[model samples]
Target chain A: MEAKNSAKERMVQSALELFHQRGIRGASVDEILKRSRAGKGQFSHYFKNKDGLVLAVVDYLEAIIRSGQVDSNYSFSSWDDFEGWFGRYIGFQKEVDCELSCPLGTIGNDLTNDQDHLRRAVKSFFDWSTAQLARFFAERKAAGELVESADPDALADLCMVVMEGGMLMSKITRSTALFERAADQVLSYIRSLR
Target chain B: MEAKNSAKERMVQSALELFHQRGIRGASVDEILKRSRAGKGQFSHYFKNKDGLVLAVVDYLEAIIRSGQVDSNYSFSSWDDFEGWFGRYIGFQKEVDCELSCPLGTIGNDLTNDQDHLRRAVKSFFDWSTAQLARFFAERKAAGELVESADPDALADLCMVVMEGGMLMSKITRSTALFERAADQVLSYIRSLR
Candidate 1:
């Protein structure tokens, strides 16, 4: 059982890495298999096909995004933390080499005409992101730091849109400068509410 | 000469429609030739290959974006006009059924590992977009309608990011409603500034 779980975990990690580097359609089963160091038999045993693997990867990504990141723990507690957290997030991407694309943004763009399951997976990820942001704003209001009319849900949605777009531009331009600038603006706007 | 120009224009229009529907890499030369109704020889005569065709399409898209849609003919003289113009610009994709994909966004996310020329083409399109938005904001500021402290360049960058991400979500969820909601938030923010 432990071995099986380990193999599955390895497959998910390999898929995430490959999917980030090469797009959903571009990353092949052989590549995933090779990266995971699993044989064809092992791969086939785990996943029905490429689509199944994609499903697994989507779930894995969504889990990580929804599990923490923007939860009450590391997000929107104060203006400084809000800006600092996001700044560090963007900065972390630059530090790691700008080649690491935003997995959700990249996949979300490519999976538009794809299968329904893929579409749902991407949507769920964004929905969760928006929800988390809304919670952050709600907390700010509860703390009396935000105006009653601030509209946390809407603001969160707007912030997500800019973030996704900024990351998309950064990936395309190979420049973190634009992302950093945009993130700064967002953080500033958030700070203004206080 | 007129006939040749019309044919080329049709080819470009057809390519944009098809490319948005079926991605640049996913769509084939044969598909483009079929959609454009141009002969094999004619396509080759016009472009070196698929990459060349993409370049033509990008140029065409850039010209269309910079033309009447922007420029001085439209008055962003008031907050309403500013929000309305920007909203319409981003939201028109729903009408054409190209809701989720920015031709440049799609290409940028897909071609992260592409060669220099392709990357440069994507960068140029975004640079033009950023510059145009900045110009619009500059005009708004010049009229003294915008906040003096407002950074036109930063706002433009943020607008670009939000619209791109909004499109991604709208496409992923297979719902045009996401863009409207996201745009409403943006429009509200613009209004709040005034």
Candidate 2:
């Protein structure tokens, strides 16, 4: 059981990295297999095919967000906490030279129209992430850190859209200027509510 | 001359439609040939290859924007002008069931990282569009219709980011709700500036 789980984990990690560097279609099953050093049978055993592995990659990305690996030092108690989170998030983009986009988004955009299973997986990830953010806002509201006029669900949705959109633009322009501008505006909106 | 122009136009038009519906990788030269009813030699004569055709598609999309074919009925004189534009834009998304994203965005995102020539083409298109928008905002400010505190260039950048970002989210969630929300917030910010 331990060996099985390790092999599965290795495949998922390899898929995630390749998918980010080269897009979904650009990265092939063979490349993923070679990178993971798993046998051909191992890939089929772990994931039925490339599509199955792609779905696993989505879950892998979601886990990274939930684990706070990206923003390990930030909390969500106040507006400032959220600002800190954004700072680290965009800072990481700059650190990577703004070459890669949000992994879920890159994969989702490529597959959303044609792959129903993949689309559903991407939607669930967004729904789950948005709910997590909404809960944070709700908690802040309950703690009197946010204004009464702020709607947790709407704010959460707004943040998700801006971040996804900003990241898309950043990737195309090969610059973080648009991302930072959008982030600043969203941050300003949050500040107004406070 | 007219026959040659028409044939070339047919290829570009066919490519635009296929790329939007099926994505860059999903569409093939033969498929485009069949759709356009152009001879196989016609594609090569007009465009060296699929990559060359993709670049032509970018130019075709840019022309649609510049020609005002999409926004022919609307004008950009004041804040209301911008609102009307957004309403029509989002409404069109609903009309199309939100399946297609900005054509330039879709193509640009796919080719940005690996294809330097395509990336530059996409960037130039964005720069032109953003500059056009900035000019509109500048006109409003000069007319004393917008607040003096508003930066036309920054506001234009903000608008592009939100729209692009919002459209991306809408495409992923398969709904226009997020797109509308992001647009409304950006509009409100513009209104606040006024």
Candidate 3:
């Protein structure tokens, strides 16, 4: 029984890594099975198909991103903290050698051809992400941190774009610096919000 | 001879379509050849392999984007025109049904695994693009049209991100609204610079 659970967990973890690094279509079922050390029978038992595996991977990736469980003391008290957050985010990518694309953005790019269930998963994440940031901005603005004239939704949405775009460029150039510079600018904008 | 040239052109065009619609690795030679109505011999004559085809397609797509052409009109002369040009740029995508990803962004996303010439081609376009935009922003700032404090390099870089990010979101939601909103905010920032 324990081995069966491990098989499913291994498949999800392997799919997350492979899909981010190799891409949805680039990573084949054999690679997943081989990497997970699970046979085809095990894979079939867990996932209906590649799409099913992809959906599970997306969920796995999203949970990691949203956990945001940095030390309670590690809070955004000032623009410096905000900027530092962006820096650390970029720093983490560099530390890993950028083998992972934002799971949502990577899948989002590949799913352009077919508007299947996979596409919905990507959209929901962006939508929820946009809203969450907007809420943060709204709170900050009410607290007199952000300029009231600033549209929380617009600013939050734009910040998301900058991060993704920076990610796209960083991945292409294999230079984590591209992300750091852009994130710095985003931090500046957030600071200049008055 | 005309038929032969046309067939090659079709193959390149179709391959670009499929590459963006599907992906670099996701797309197969058979799919491209079939779409182009060309035989294996004809394809081999034009391209050594998939990489050769990608290089040609990258050049083709880049030409189309560049041909949209930069406006000589400065931000100082007419902020409205600047805004309009930016709007038209974002608006054009909506009319196309979110079928095309930004060439640089799309290629960047796919190039993660392509280690040879294809990756270099994509990186070159992005570097050149960022430089050109930075020059434009600097020129505008010199003319007193843009805020002196605004970093041309950073702003140009942000524009790249904003556009790429907007494209990603637009494709995911199957809606043009996000692109339009993001573009509007940029235009607003540009106008504010004036």
Candidate number of the best DockQ = 2
Q: Count the backbone clashes (under 3 Å) in each candidate.
A: 2, 1, 0
TM-score for candidate 2, please give it.
0.92
Tens-place lDDT digits, model 3, residues B86-166: 455456567667666665567568765546467778878777767767787787888877777788888777776776777
- Looking at candidate 1 chain B, the ten consecutive residues that score lowest on lDDT are B69-78
Provide the TM-score for each candidate, comma-separated: 0.87, 0.92, 0.89
Compared with the true structure, what per-residue lDDT tens digits does model 3 show for residues A57-159?
Answer: 8777666666754321123445555556556657657876764556678887887455578888877877877777677778789888877678878777667
Sort the predicted structures by TM-score, highest score first. Answer: 2, 3, 1
Model 1 share of native interface contacts: 0.61
Give the alpha carbon lDDT tens digit for every residue of A78-102 in model 1: 6666656556557756865666567
Query: lDDT (0-100) at residue A128 of candidate 1?
Result: 76
Cα RMSD for predicted model 3: 3.3
Stretches off by above 4 angstroms in model 3 are A1-5, A69-81, A98-100, A112-115, B1-5, B69-81
Estimate, for each residue in A84-137, the C-alpha lDDT of model 2 and write its tens digit.
765775776788787777778778778745588898888888888778778888
- Pairs that collide in candidate 3 are none
TM-score of the B chain in each candidate versus the native B chain: 0.83, 0.91, 0.83
Candidate 1 deviant stretches above 4 angstroms = A4-7, A69-76, A112-114, B2-11, B69-78, B96-99, B176-178
Better of 2 and 3 by lDDT: 2
Best by TM-score: 2
**What would the per-residue lDDT of candidate 2 be over residues B43-110, giving only the tens digit for each residue?**
88988888999999998787787777875223476666778766776776788788877777778777
